[model samples]
Target: MAAKPNTVNPAQKKKQRAFEGVCKSLIPFARAAAVIASVALLLFLTPFVGIYNKDIPGMEITVGGFSAALCALSGQFTNVGAAFGNMDIFNHFAPAHCKVLAACAAAAALCLLAALVLCVVLAIGKAPGLHSAAAVLQALAFAALIVSFAFALAMSGTRLLPEYCSGNPACSVRSLAILPALAACAGCAVNFAAALRYRKAKKNI
Candidate 1:
């Protein structure tokens, strides 16, 4: 008796080919977009949103966002309170809850940096392992941002010294603080989506 000849299913082969084609066509664009978004996120977090301080005449204290390293306007005062691991000037003067907010902000910043590095690697390399790594990093970054934003809201809602704000209208949380996290989240979404596509394409192929 003769054994049956090996065979391939035409329909399945066509479907797999089509899927691979789509993935190949779109993966590069997706990766590029993710890179752009990640860079934007880094820029937002670095110089723009980390601190916002406004000093006016006759105001004794400067008020603004509390960060882990230093206060927003540390330059204005002689002693800006303790450095990293402790409250800055803003946190010292504002409510205790500001410490929690500062910590969350710091964590988010670190996560964003990690995500940025992973994104750059993903864009440069096409290895299957790298894609998965990027996906996980982006997800973690997103979670960190969520926590940071939550703490920020809590600090803001409680009112960072109502008396200070009432007297000094210039002293307030800058809206820019939230923009970086938002942009970072957007970047994470793009990178994760691209990773998923790449994985699917590999599996299909």
Candidate 2:
């Protein structure tokens, strides 16, 4: 006689279904968690940035440009020193005239973190609209980062601020600019990864 065939009983089937449901629920969240972890690592490595320059104005063009942008966006740069939305908006004062540059850098870090998380969630969700938007935002962020790197280099090389180099150790504005540039690069990288993941997920699906 032949052996009895194995069967998936009703209870076993129900348990399997439940397990699958849990996995489906966790997939998006797990991707989100990974994005957050990456952002956190960047934050931990970022130095505690001070006012763009405590010493001189001309040597702080990068900081000044950041301040002017913040000031224009928020209307008062110094009020928001070292924090978000605090810079004066009119660009009346060059980046060196205000303390808002540091604030803008901090804000950029937060925005990039948010962007990373959003991109990861959108990718895992496999939403076409969200993924497209993330890709666009990532591109813009990359562009901004590139421009920032250029400005930083320009400021570091200019001889406008002799005081910056007069210190015992003689620090350059590049010293300050380098940190934000690195942070911006990290943001661009993560956003790009998220976009790729979104594309891959779409293809797989």
Candidate 3:
């Protein structure tokens, strides 16, 4: 008996080339996404949610992640005296939601950090294994953030960033606070593309 020679079919070879090209092309995009995620993390620590002070420019009182958590728990929205009573009166009855916002914020930050690490690795080299995982983590980070703010608004009437309160005559809006979510959008899209590319490559092989 003689050994049979193994070879890849031309169609498979073509698919392989396409895969490699796509992956190579996406590297720069991955790096860009990593940088955007970094910015999101930094901004994540800043006060994205707050009430703009009309009397003083830049005096807009905002709370960062943790502080915002506390404010929401305390049912304080504006970070001012009268604002202590700003939360919906019904919110006063529910104490079980305590620490929910803080936990959500913490989860979002941690997930983003982990996703950022994976994105950097993917940007530096071929990390097909990490592509899907990274994409999921980044998506979760954004979702967690949304949940936190949604809870804040429904429970405490807190407004900032994605929350539109500009219509209020006495307050200003921090429209720029939406930057982190924007960054996450970039991060998620790049990783998703990378993941799909790898999946196709594996099937071809």
Query: For model 2, what is the error of residue 1's alpha carbon versus the real structure, in angstroms, after optimal superposition?
Result: 51
Off by over 4 Å in 3: 1-19, 66-98, 154-177
- lDDT score for candidate 2 against the true structure: 0.44
lDDT digits (tens) for residues 76-143 of candidate 3: 54344433322222223323332465556667777888988887888887675688888898888787
lDDT of each: 0.50, 0.44, 0.63
Best by lDDT: 3
| Superposed Cα deviation of residue 108, candidate 3 (Å) | 1.0
Provide the lDDT at 129 for model 1: 45
Q: Which ten residues in a row have the lowest lDDT in candidate 2?
A: 84-93
- Higher-TM-score candidate of 2 and 3: 3
- What is the RMSD, in Å, between candidate 1 and the native fold over all Cα? 6.3
What does candidate 1's lDDT look like per residue over 1-205, in tens digits? Answer: 9999989899789878887565555546446645654564554333211222366443233222233324322332224443332234345444444545555455555666566666555555544345555556555655655554555445444445364356455554433445555666676666667667766766775
Expressed as tens digits, the lDDT of each residue in 22-64 for candidate 2 is 4344445435534643543354233222224555653333333
Better-scoring candidate (TM-score), 1 or 3: 3
Off by over 4 Å in 2: 1-72, 75-114, 123-129, 157-160, 163-169, 175-205
